[model samples]
Target: MGPIATTFPVLGVAAWSSTGKTTLLVELLPRLRAAGLEVGVIKHAHHDFDIDKPGKDSYRLREAGAAPTLVASARRYALMQETPNQDEPDLVHLLSLMEPHAPDLVIVEGFKQWPIAKLVLYRDDIGDPGILACENVQAVALKGAAPDTLEASIVRLDLDNIDAIAHWILQWCAAFPDHER
Candidate 1:
């Protein structure tokens, strides 16, 4: 219900299937850490999931009508619950839970529909022009020439050049530290 205290700015990495988004995230995260920035990651799931199983005590407790049931141990914890509404929680709500140890940057691996600044992954192999239709993309990681119709704000880069991509993200982070706050 209140604002969460956080240090790292939030960013989104978006791309179509096989566009190399995950590859980029894997490479960039450690590099960002090497630059002394603590990084947190959020991956959006497209399917139904169960972190708690039916036979588990936590699952039974929830079935018995516990709201927001939490099962914890020294090693890990799990909270299982259902929201009252059909709408999913937005980015802000999700990030608030990471507070008290918010990393220097939060890299979101999906949610391409949102307004946050993003690096759009593109591949000529995907053969789809969805990237051309995306709005608010801060840059493009692609294998070929970026379409002239693409927004002027989108900085284009060679997808194979991990160093260039990493440097571009760091620069973006430096320029928008306040966004992380």
Candidate 2:
């Protein structure tokens, strides 16, 4: 697929470890939903995790050499796939899978290595915390003062103001349905 993300905008929330990325997302998701937009979230996990417990049928099945064990219910479902010897998950593939759902926006958390339009959150309390030089960072949200070294081109946002942040993201989605390079 040639530049698949160009067809639909994928916004990313990037921050250093313990920078409250999840806390922001948890609050922001509802606001986005209240604004009458369907949002999809893709979170990148750094550690190994298992949603199903050992005694659970799905977990037992997966442990019994099943490559993927899908657990479903009337309300929700989860698909667990094992990738032995795999180093990293292919984000593009995940995007392709979610494309059918046709969400108004897709917000990605973590996966800082990708060249996507992202809002980087920062806190001055973190030891030597500074803005990362991610190529596609559209905005730098800060709890305190924006670093003097920050470029004038990048928009500065208030990290503690969820409504303002949400509004900025909403405007960004409207301006660039297909964003960044």
Candidate 3:
């Protein structure tokens, strides 16, 4: 079969570590949901991580060589897959996993190198170089005053204004071809 079609809009919140990417999402998600959007999140971890707890049956199953250990409960469900000695799955593959639920938007927390349109977050105090020149960076969210060297055409958003940022994302999603808000 050919590749599955994806209709939902995807946006990445790109930033260096400790730049409040998760914190921004924590604030942004509820606003997006309240505005009647079903949002899915895809977070990329740079190191090994585990959602399953040790001694849990699901964890034991995974450790016992189950390719994907799925545990379901009345409230929610989780699927954990083992990829020992394997390369990390690319963004497309990961996004495909979200297709069944059909979220209105997918907010990616990392994958900064991917070509998806992203809002670059920065903290001037960290002194990390800006990623405005990177591919598909449509806007920048600054924690402090706008850097003097930033390009004038790039959209700048106040890092603390959750409402405005949420509004901007909603507008952007609506602008997507065949996208209905």
Best by lDDT: 3
Q: How accurate locally, in lDDT, is each candidate?
A: 0.77, 0.82, 0.85
- Stretches of model 1 off by over 4 angstroms after superposition: 1-7, 178-181
Looking at candidate 1, the ten consecutive residues that score lowest on lDDT are 1-10
The residue-by-residue lDDT of candidate 1 on 8-77, one tens digit each, is 6778898887677777888888888888788888887766777888888889988889999999999988
Clashing pairs in 2: none
List TM-scores for all candidates, in order: 0.81, 0.91, 0.92
What clash pairs does model 1 have?
8-104, 9-180
Number of the top-ranking candidate, with TM-score as the measure: 3
Model 2 C-alpha lDDT versus the unseen true structure: 0.82
> Candidate 3 on 1-181: residue-level lDDT in tens?
2323477988989988888999999999999999999999999988899999999998888888888888999999998877777676578888899999989999989988787888989888764665656677778888887778778887899988888899899988998778866
lDDT of 3: 0.85
- After superposition, which runs of candidate 3 have C-alpha atoms over 4 Å from their true positions? 1-5
Clashes of each: 2, 0, 0
Global CA lDDT computed for model 1: 0.77
